[model samples]
Target chain A: MSIFINKQTRVLVQGITGKQGSFHTAQMLEYGTNIIAGVSPGKGGQNVEGVPVYDTVFAAIEEETVDASILFIPAPFARDAAFEALDAGVKLIVLIPEHIPLQDAMDIMAYAQKQNAVIVGPNTFGLVSSGSSKIGIMPNRYFVPGPVGIVSRSGTLCYEIVGHLTGNDIGTTTVVGLGGDRVVGLNFIDVLRRFEEDPETKTVILVGEIGGSSEEEAATFISSSMKKPVIAYLAGRSAPPGKRMGHAGAIIERGRGTFESKVKALNAAGVEVAGLPNEVPAMIKKILS
Target chain B: MKLYEYLGKKLFHRYDIPVPHSKIVESPEEAAEAAAELGDVVIKSQVLSGKRGKAGGIAFASNPGEARKEAERILNMRLNDLTVEKLLVEEKLQIEQELYLALTVDGALRCPVVLASLDGGMDVEEVAEGRMIKWPIDVSIGLQDYMTREICRRMGVSGALQKEFIKLLPKLYKMFRELDAELAEINPLALTPDGLVAADAKVTIDDDALYRHPQLPRVKEKTDLELKAEELDIAYVELDGNIAVMANGAGITMATLDMVQHYGGAAANFLDFGGGASVERTAQALELLLGTNPKVLLINIFGGITRCDIVAEGFVKVRESKGIDLPVSFRLVGTKEAEGRAILEKVGIKTFNSMDEAVRHAVDLTEAS
Candidate 1:
């Protein structure tokens, strides 16, 4: 019923031996994610959090039933790990690493797309299907099963949206953190399209920041194919030009990625735009009503 | 992560790229000496971030005395919040044509993207306004020899200069790769009255990639404000806004900062205390933030592995010890959330379960302030 992830998805963890990989793996497992197996070179034959570890993604695929793979590998090795999972027929993957060298990130994403795979983030904070599959590092307690689908560039802000939705008795069907990295594997438009098609996702909440034309692109897409009501909010409106906000990708450089331009673009596209984060829930409520 | 122009040019020169004769000056005497080294020199303020020229960081002096004055002025000034601790004085370039060339990772395509423009000597921003010769190169293929050649040819580089262009591209590309640079730019990659000389160079190394290349560049703690924040060892990213945020850990702190922006408020800084922030540390962190003269403060802490009691203890100490000199709002969740709230409430501040409420209150308070 939902897009990308739901109760049925069984995920695997790549690079499960590293500190971040193992820590998040344990957290996801504890959050009730079906982390079927873990993969790390030379860490095979060991068990973490009751999940079997394998040497490579291919090995992990063979040993366990996996619907998706979340990459926690270092940037240098992320390219090969992603390709390995894709080659082994991992249909869906999410990359949680940031600052991936641009070249490697592109080749793998292109390669994965050619293989008909869906990649979430290169510098992303994974996606979650409330109470079903927990990926990345989003707080589990903050999410509840609901009809709204949420996508954001900022992971921390997503909690605010989720908390808003939760406060209003609106729970997300799936919340996706696209990350604020400049060169990410997926953008808001990509995830929005998926949510648009999903039967369970009745409405969508998009959280964008003042950087890049990704929001503009998403707005254009929303004006056309987006059948569901989409309420969007963009952060950093007053951010000075060329001042990089907390996120790497959320910088206003040479007037390309400005909050004003994006707001105009989104407003022009017939999408109800919340001027600020606090107004998001009210806007969404207005759209639904 | 951003390299000063002089340092970037030094790396450029090491790769055999021709540049104006240059030396960095730490003192006004050295500045005069550097200007003396070149009959006519360009005194450029050494700041880490971009748009130095727009910030009046670059000044040209025809005489050593003028250059010394320019250097002296710059060294004491702050450009775009970056202090000019040094000046890069270089031989004045008789630039005939200023071309633009940069090798950067394209986010959309997830590959190395090369942008080239023929219009030279003007701000690259102006050329960016015009159409650019954009080529997206797959990393597996790397920078192809033919494309680099084609790019040079398109930019009207020819003869010995074309060959030099050919040589320059690959070497620069190699250096870019070797350094794990996120961005490498040769603005005014020029055909001078002399030859192909890089008028200016800028390179930003990926922080994540720094572990592999230890000597590349340490994350230099810049800015007196940032340095002061560093005294408390808080992860702080200063913003142009009037609202300050102090939270534990990079991730949550970033979230709180973003939330501020989301709710139509700007965060003055991104300060992360990491996991398990003690009361002493929290007070010091608060003290550092107080220096920012924030209209209001929003402190969001999620204590899981780091206990809420510890965070509560920190909050109480910051208030009891520092006497709450600033207008602030706080949110404490997970692991003794109740206790965290109780401690804050006793100090006349309230905690919220919803970030929406905390952010709204903080934004309104700051706006009112």
Candidate 2:
């Protein structure tokens, strides 16, 4: 009853022999994710945690059916890995590396669109559909299956807020980290529309930040056609202007992507916007009741 | 990551882009000497931030004496919070038209966008009111000649002028891609008597891609604390406060800063170790945080790819090596959470899983101090 993934969603790990890829591959396995294959160019005949490793995604797809892929490739090689996955007919991709070159990200985005596939991040923690399955690197225990579908542009901030929501017994159907980059694969609008269509997701939580206009676009979408109750929280209210606050996309430029502008947009769209992350649960509770 | 005007011009020259002759100078005497060689110069205060024209950072000097006087005035001036330490003395152009040209990523379009306008020599923000022509380029095909011609024609360029833009747009796009630059800009591509030349250059290379570009000049625009953090490979932004804040991700760090301010506490800096920080890297981050001289150190870790036990070890390593004696609050969660808490507790460091509780404790401790 989740949006992107569940128990039946078979997955593969790209760059699975790397340190991070190996560690998280084991973690995802322990979380009961339906991992089917692993890809490492040189170590083709090897096996990582009982999953067969192949030289390429196409070679891996030759033996088994993989519905999604989690990429742990280095930033420089991430584009090629992504293109290979798309070319192999894998529709969903979770890119874990940060600091990917902007041009490569653009190319990946265009290529993914042409294939009608979904790429989650160029810099992200990935996604988890509560107890059903997890494709990202987020700590899965903090989440539980429920009606609230979460979408965010951040990683740890999403974790902290989800911790608060789950602590208060407000579980989630799916939580998506839209990534913390300038040109991400999927944005708030795309995730929001998916959540709106999912029957299990009655409420949605949109976590946005300063720097880009994705939140503004989400506000426009919510105001016009959204039917589900949504609560929004934006970070970087006190962040200094112009300086990039850690994230490449999390910056204020030419007086745009300010906290004031995003808040105003969300509020004008008849959406309840929490000034602080702690206020999210209360706002969500009030709306659902 | 942001190159000064002189440096940007050097890059422009290397890429065969036409630029006005320029030389960088620190002292007024040096400026005078350079201006004498290139007469009728423009004395531009070399600061990273834009809008130098409005800040009076750009001055026209017809003579070497005027250039010297202008440099003296500007070298001691502060524009947009950045002090002018250097000047770019360049030959002034006999301009006929000013056009804007930039290659940057368009977040909304999810592609590289080329922006052009007939009106330039002004901040693009000032003229974004429907006067600019924007073309989002498909990265696979790149900035095609037809797209360039269409953008130039829309910007009111025609005939020879349109052809010039078509030739230059791809070069700009190439510079942006080759350098891994976030922005490759010519604010005023002046149509001078000598033909179209870049009057001003604004190039910003991605800090993450600096490893790929060893030839690019490393500008020291950061403060002492920021520079130290950069050495440790941590993202740090200095702020005016007494409480130093650290986190695993940007969004959480920002939220932590906001929460500290909400509780009447100011954060001294914003630092993120990113994901999957090793023990030594974490220890280095902690050591760098202490360099800020804060009243209290607030460490917030929400481990996803980053394990909490490793972060806990980083704290202990810093405490043992650097002899940290300041009041510190720790918020640790996810992957090996209990083990992380136990490690911190063994070292007499109390840990809280709740971010709110940790922030509140840190603010209270700092306020008491």
Number of the top DockQ candidate: 2
- Predicted candidate 2 versus true structure: per-residue lDDT over B1-369, tens digit per residue: 889988999988888899998888999999889989999999999888877989999998988899889999999888988889889999999999988889888988898888888889887888865779989988877778889878876777798888788777788888999988889999898998777899999998888778778888898889987888888778999999999888999999999999998888999999998888999999888888888788999999888778889999988988998898999999898888899999989989998878889999999998788
lDDT of 1 by residue, B211-280 (tens): 6777764647477877776556566777878888877544356556667876788888877765556667
The stretch of ten residues in a row with the least summed lDDT in candidate 2 chain A is A138-147
Tell me the TM-score of each prediction against the true structure: 0.85, 0.96
DockQ of 1: 0.35
- Please list all clashing residue pairs in model 1, or write none if there are none: A106-B110, A146-A171, A183-B107, A277-B262, A277-B263, B98-B120, B249-B274, B279-B314
RMSD (Å) per prediction: 4.1, 1.8
Model 2 lDDT on a 0 to 1 scale = 0.89
The all-Cα superposition gives candidate 2 an RMSD in Å to the true structure of 1.8
TM-score of the A chain in candidate 2?
0.98
**Model 2 over residues A1-289: C-alpha lDDT tens digits?**
8888999999999999999899889989988899999999989999999999999999999999999999999998998999999999999999999988887888899999899999999788899999989998888688888889999999999988998898899999999999888988888888999999999998999998998888888999999979998888899999988788988888898889999999999999888888778888888788778
